[model samples]
Target: MRNRSHIHQLFEALAPKTEQKEKMLQNILVQSRNEKIRHRGFAPVKRLRSAVLAAVLMAGLTTTAFAAAYMGLDEAFLKFLNPVNHEQAQYLSNGAYVVDKQVTNENGTLTIKQVIGDSNLTYILMDFSAPEGTVLDAARYRFLDNDITTRQNFQSVGFKALDDGNRSDNKISLVMSVMTRNSIAGQKVHLRLKDLQAADPLPGIFETIIPGTWETEFKLDFKDYSTLYPVNQNITMYGYEAVLKSISVSPISITLKVDSSYLEEINEAAGELKEIGDNKHLDNFPITINYADGTSETTAIFSGLYLSEHISEQILMIKTFENVINDKEIASIVFFDKEIPIQTGR
Candidate 1:
């Protein structure tokens, strides 16, 4: 029986430990399963967080780029408005002729002088050469009330060859209508001139001819008269006459002069257009017609054609002149027969 007990004790020592050891092993297995489930649940949350962060970063970058582009555009516009030099201003001023004094006005009335340039086109050069310390009101002369009924003539002489038989002259006459400061309401004045005819054919050369009847209309602007010439102020008007001397195909030359009582009417239609804005209409726009002779006629054509061609050109020229004066360059100033584009801040 003692030997049996000893064998039983040896078997117990060799056998695995039970109860407490079993409990520890079960606890370790449950912890490993819980850790694997927690890692699987957190994987989707980490991916979602990364995606949201990336989206926000992209939005911020896009906004920053747009702001930079806007700033660059503004800077470019400003540079065009302010030119760095003043050469253009001087050119326009020097080219213009001003009639500013009373004595020169009297001399112009007595005898007109011719202005020489590329074309025999005539322009009145106002004798603005006044003595120092003279206080002349309004240093420019505009057409005022005048009584002159003479038909002015313009002639263009062309040469077909150098000292050969190819020579011809074209002549046209335009009548002048009397201008008056006194209001002539309901009474229309008509300016009549000789019909324009083509020049005689030149021997051994093709004849070039310009067609269509030349006429223009004139109207009195009370506001412009009041602003430019105040009440009881004496101003002189001059008449223009042109004569084309030796005219070759290349480098044509002409001589022009103004009679004592005539002056080239400045285009005041542009001012009227601006005052009316988008609702403006161009039915009665004014035009100055240049004839083959040394004379021009002012008339008004209340048709759509005049608005599309002549008046439109005048508007574009004025706009371009203003932009250039302000040191700005518009890509291309186009004037259609229809309504002009709206103009904003200078």
Candidate 2:
């Protein structure tokens, strides 16, 4: 967590107990490092106490409309993002499937509450609780493991929001989403949460990690809401004329594949104009999803991109909606001014 100026101010205003805990954590990490140097070898490091991150950093206290006691995939996202239209919201709600499986240890319990997916993304709701103290929070705690191991390969993962309104020192109501890149929907996903530790801290925000191995192996079973269709639609983005490769739609997100023109070696004589049209300007692509009902929504292109097998030949531009979207209800996708009609199953 890079320290933004505002985050430091917020920490200064935190409770004294929280302040002390942060200092204590920094000192403890230093102490741990020293201990490691002193020891010869062949010894397991002792773990430290974990803290609950009650503050949902993304929403900053904005409460989303969560209609149910248990949040579905849509509710989890809505808690920290813009509200979707009624119909799209309903589709998201129906697609969410429960995965009540959980694992408990001395630190607390880590439960896999629910999971939902599309062809390119997986959204998982996880709850971590500690009886001794709150140990999981977006502000500070995260799984030691970086990627979710799949039978095929290791998939990159990211955190969405931490539940803000829980009672425990940690978010007693802590809810976190682990989004993965692999298209492993409807298949089993092997998760090894070695331990929870201090997340990338917003410098001076706080330090101190909850330590304990919740070495639990579980399977992720969820509904696959993705549909793939070839889209030969021509696009003129940033003046780069190229065919829109294809699209994969699911309730969670939409992915667009575009041909990469950057593969050519830098030709200084060709002028800078050639490179300008490539993926360099994809972030500026204005795409809209128009539904059959006459409603349309603009996409918020995701900041980061997934790894591509053929990186030199093509680029994958990921787009997400403020609210969830259903594929069947989609009538066409508008790329800039051109509207490409979507014929389901075609």
Q: Model 2, poorest ten-residue lDDT window? A: 45-54
lDDT of 1 by residue, 235-333 (tens): 222212211111111011111111212122323323343323332344233333233233443323221111112322221011111112221221111
Global local distance difference test of model 2: 0.55
Candidate maximizing TM-score: 2
Per-candidate TM-scores read 0.18, 0.60
Candidate 2 on 1-346: residue-level lDDT in tens?
2223333333333213776879987986786577557653634432211111234423433443222212344333445332234444445555666676688877678777776666666767777776764545445556656445665443456554455555345543333444344477556656667556554445423243656665444555555677777887766555555567788776557777766464232122223422333223233455788887888877443333444344456656566554455567788887754677776531
Q: Against the unseen true structure, what C-alpha lDDT does each candidate score?
A: 0.25, 0.55
Off-target runs (Cα >4 Å) in candidate 2 are 1-90, 134-141, 152-154, 171-182, 195-208, 234-241, 261-282, 291-297, 304-312, 326-329, 336-338, 343-346
**TM-score for predicted model 2 compared with the true structure:** 0.60
